[model samples]
Target: MAAYEIKFRDARELAEALKALGADMRSLPFFDNRREIRSVYITDVDVRAANVIKQEMLSRGGDAAVHAHAVDCGVTESDVILFGTVKQISFLADKLETMPWWGFPDTVKVLREALASFSKKPATIDLPSGSSLAFGGRTLLMSIINLSDDSFHSESRTYGNVDVAVARAVEHAKDGADILDLGAESTRPGAARISESEEIGRIMPVIREIRKILPLMPISVDTTREKVAKTALEAGADIINDISGLTFEPGIARAVADHNAMLVIMHMRGTPETMGSMCIYSNLLKEINDFFDEKIRTAISSGVDRAKIILDPGVGFAKDYSQNLFLLRHLESFRIHSKPILIGASRKGSVGKATDSPDTAGRLEGTLAVSALCAWAGVDIIRVHDTKENKKAVMMAEAIRNADYA
Candidate 1:
């Protein structure tokens, strides 16, 4: 399966593949109909204002439900579950401010923030290195420079050689990679964890060499240990891409906070060695979104700047193929958190499963397909091995996505 088969070239070809997969978009009338009606659960709402809130929601094609027996018993507090579109919720937040009951004398602060998270999401992130990348404009590519010999994708592996890694870094930078990610520790399922000293030994030279050549290149060190993160940042790496989300090393967040470097908090269930067997989620997307909220708050509490944070939903990390597809399809939905999103699906097992391809070498086109979708969905960063090919695909998709703008 070293040779990747070309299954689809154009929309017709893609449609044919979808047809074979038991999906016919032409017959599916709901393709372009996007209605996002979110349910907001407001706990311990003053029961006195329940009627007013219920009336206000119903006026805007929404509804707020309280305990069915609350009105009769005159309960002082009731859980309010309001269902409405993002626009309707924003308006309702404002409406509640003037109701003279739940409305405060000064401003409706809590409701404003709750609704704002969904309505006015952010489109860009500022890094500590005085650079910023705006999402919803173009797709940013991060080329993979794996210093580990046992990474899932053999092509991405540099065989633990700094020279080969540096050469690949130069090519990635030359091919318009917006960032270069150097990973010394392999996060592939069941891969053994390396010592912090060994990991630094493997990557510090490559990081320094890349910085010497591309001084302004954004370099991210992928690790789950604090000492590795500290030494890597001090050695010139710009971002700490922690797959554990600060659960592995308790002090890693502090290390990133102390250096004021950028953070990539990926949502993985367990260590690489344990994650494969831990591929279970009661509600995949909800659990991930909730995890992101908790982790982001934890990072902020640890003193890491919120503006420097990026999110990767951890594709293929403790996720099955169908779950990975769901995450990819809803990448745009994460915009509600107002942070940059980076998805690294390059040559992963899910892509191989999608295209009936085998191994990392056979998933190039499948990976390209994901790059196009991420670009179209306004994902901030795409980490890939084939930087040049992905750059072209993302650039074209971005151009089309922004073609109507003046």
Candidate 2:
């Protein structure tokens, strides 16, 4: 089943979108008939286009409801809510393109693109090094390689110890891990930030070792700084797992763009030092969605290829324990962006709280619990320290959700 919805570049908030995954194996839309048509909300519509759109939709067996002020000239801006089947919307799309004036052509383009995005979401991503990964088809594990000594998970902290780091990387690979994410600077709350040079120094040897030993493995350099990212990429890292979503450093986007590398953009409210204090939000999910929307625009405008981008909701970066649990439960809502989502809730404080395990290392069960649920929710990537255990959870949940018992 396919859904019908409108997406505008500058429109204000619309109603709650009807989005979720089902066992039917149907694509984006749920259904395409009069009995199951979806609503398209368009905010910030100008008077000229609003009137034209209202009349046009009405003639095509659908109708647009507009604010009353649009007719009386009381309000300069009009918000129009259109309801129709996919076929009827297609008719309006065609009719709008042929119109000579009053912003119909632009509206036509927006409508067409929105409809396409809403209908089909490509799950495979092409990497920069001439490879591609298919997501939403199977569960992929991204093992964490925290290179900072002050990392919350003591077991994962290598503290720039190359020998220890290499061993962990090798262990993760042997544990059926699909990917390795090497992070030099710890983003744990109140953890000290390292300089760019120091960060590069800490992770370079580990990245080099991984590339030399496991040349086929995909390595992601998890840093927000462009200098470290570029250096790491030069050292054979294929992806930039930016915690700041390219916000901390303005140059990070173009660096990834220039390298033509893969990008994993995670969302966080503030810096690690400040995030704990600023964790409050009126609506956590909606704000995260808005953050993704803004970052996507910024990335594209800064020359990033959309296909190479992935999303992570930043589970414990700024969120409290309850909020983190809420995000994992409704993880499906983040799918609206049509990008692969990475859940890095491995041994975070939230997991510790959930399982009543005060120590981060003992939260393996709690971590696997989130991983299994995310796999069931169709999340593409699960970053965890316990690769083997998380893999089991993912496979078991996937077996039930996808009916792949074997």
Candidate 3:
């Protein structure tokens, strides 16, 4: 086991400080505002040395407690001390560097430096179903059930009827969908926005009916409005899947936090109405990363828990053909945030562009191909229209990932 101590003047500085310390910037856990403490991790071999280091800190006018493990380090124990302040922590790091037992001096040095320059509050989220999905591990599946008549993919769009949608939801559950994402509006580029009443009318009934049978399966409402999310949660929805990433609607984050519902914060530069025009990025990957960082911070400030938050790369949302391809190829870059990643590239315009399939239904193979790629890259979730096929692809990819370990 490894032990670590996180000491910060405040929680806001912890994230930036951790980044400076060379802690995997992307994998840092979300910190609650009230818990504004730093973590110092030490391995079992370093435990004795760590205790000596703690004693040194106490002697140097710093108060620290020993806990068995560090929260972010993924270690489980209670043998390490929780340091009280940053001033005492700063001197403690300096003292440890001079000690022989501080073998990983560089790691220690980076952590100390990170503490000095830390800023930015971490994001946190909570979900209705009582299960929290965080970053890391195999991708999570967000099965697509479009209720619009003119969805980019014909195979996905239902006739906005309750029977069809409920049957589809049951099928998706049988096909191994981790979550059923129900959407009434079509977000295809150039698609017109529907009225709020119409959108709710089309989706609420379907959600209500599905909850009757698959009551325990988490359901994510795909909308950018606070009303839609609020209504959905009231109708038994478990998560909010926002393609606008909570930027489109006012007070949406509060609704999510208020309901303790998980929120899928997707990355898209503009509204679906004009997103095609905003598909340019000087550095697509970096820009997406920065976008997520900002959104994650915003979500946290709004009271969403870090554990219940999921990230979507927004594959075809605002990206052009080439840029969309680039995002899919480099999806692994999102691991920096250490939150579960949900990639929605199923039978979108990008797949149609790649396969020259003018019809959305004709792109199922292409969608499955990308789904396989996402699974291979260790994505946490692959949002798709074809549940069975994508599930098969994920299982196959998992076999490959487990081959060496097995």
Lowest summed lDDT across 10 adjacent residues in model 1 is found at: 27-36
Would you list the rank order by lDDT, best first? 2, 1, 3
lDDT per residue (tens digit) for residues 120-159 in model 2: 3447666654456777577799999888888888888887
Report how far off residue 24 is in candidate 3 (Å): 28
lDDT per residue for candidate 1 within 1-406, as digits (tens), equals 3766443322434555556768867753232111456776655676666666788889999888888855764687776777886667777777766766553322255456455555334455555455555654577898889899888888788888888889898888889988888999899988998888889899888888877887878888999989999999888888999998877885878888888888999998877888887778876766887788899999999999888888999998998888889999877556657788899999898898889998778899999999999988778899998999999999889777655312
lDDT of each: 0.79, 0.79, 0.74
Model 1 clash pairs? none
Question: Runs in model 1 with CA error above 4 Å?
Answer: 1-55, 62-86, 96-136
User: What is candidate 1's CA lDDT for residue 215?
Assistant: 80
Report the candidate with higher TM-score, 1 versus 3: 1
Candidate 2: lDDT of 344? 89
Candidate 3: misplaced stretches above 4 Å? Answer: 1-126, 130-137
With candidate 1 superimposed using the best TM-score fit, by how many Å does residue 298's alpha carbon deviate from the native?
1.7
TM-score of each: 0.78, 0.75, 0.69
